[model samples]
Target: MTDTEIRAGIAEVARAHLGYEGELLDDTSLVEALRLDSVRLLTLVAELENHFRVVLEDGDEAGIEHVADLVAVLRRRIG
Candidate 1:
C-alpha cells in the first residue's frame, strides 16, 4: 500500500483505539500530539500492527518519535 494509505490507517487506529482525533503530520510528535502514556502507546502499536498486518519488531518502537517515523517503519515492513 502507499504511504498515504498507511498514514490514514494509523490515524484510524489512533482514533479507534486511543481516542485521538487530531491531524497527524510528518513532524508531529507522537507523545506530544497523542498524549500517550505507555499503555496507550502499546495499544496503538498493537492496533497498528493488526491494522497493517505487520509484526513490528520489539526495537521498532524505540526509534519511533514522530508520525513520519512510524510511517517509515510500517512502509518498510509492508514492503
Candidate 2:
C-alpha cells in the first residue's frame, strides 16, 4: 500500500481506538493531540502491527511520537 493509504489506515485506527475526532493532519502529534497514555499507545502499536503484518522493534518504539511517525514506520514495514 502507498504511504497515503497507510496513513489513512493509521488515522482510522487512531480514531477508533483513541476517540480522536479531529482532523488527522500529517504533522499532528498523537501524544500531544490525542493525549495517548502508555497503555493506549501500546495498544495502538499492537493494532498497527496486526494491520500491517510487521513487528516493530522495541527500540523503534521510542521514535514514534505522532501519527506521522507511525505512518513512516508503517510505510517502511509495508514496503
Candidate 3:
C-alpha cells in the first residue's frame, strides 16, 4: 500500500480504536499528539498489524516517536 493509504488506515484505526479525532500529520508526535501510553501504543500496533496483515517484530516500535515513523515502519513491513 502507498504511504497515503497507510496513513489513512492509521487515522481510521486511531479514530475507531483510540478515540482520537484530531489530524494526524507526518510530524505529529505519537506521545505528545496522541498521548499514547504503553498499553495504548500496543493496542495501536496490534490493530495496525491486523489491519495491514503484517507481524511487527518485537522492538520494532522502539524509535517510533512520530506518525511518520509508524508509517515508515508499516510501509516497510507491508512491502
Steric clash count of candidate 1: 0
Per-residue CA lDDT of candidate 1, range 1-79, in tens? 9888989999999999888899999889999988889898889888988999999987877778999999999999999
TM-score of each: 0.94, 0.84, 0.93
For model 1 the local lDDT of residue 28 reads 93
Candidate 3 per-residue lDDT, tens place, 1-79, comes to: 8999999999999998899999999999988876788899889988998899999998888898899999999999998
lDDT of 3 at 16: 88
lDDT tens readout by residue for model 2, 32-64: 877878899788888878777898886776677
How much lDDT does each candidate structure score?
0.90, 0.79, 0.90
Count of clashes, each model: 0, 0, 0
Which residue window of length 10 is worst by lDDT in model 3?
30-39
What TM-score does prediction 3 earn? Answer: 0.93
Once fitted onto the true fold, the runs of candidate 2 whose alpha carbons sit more than 4 angstroms away are none
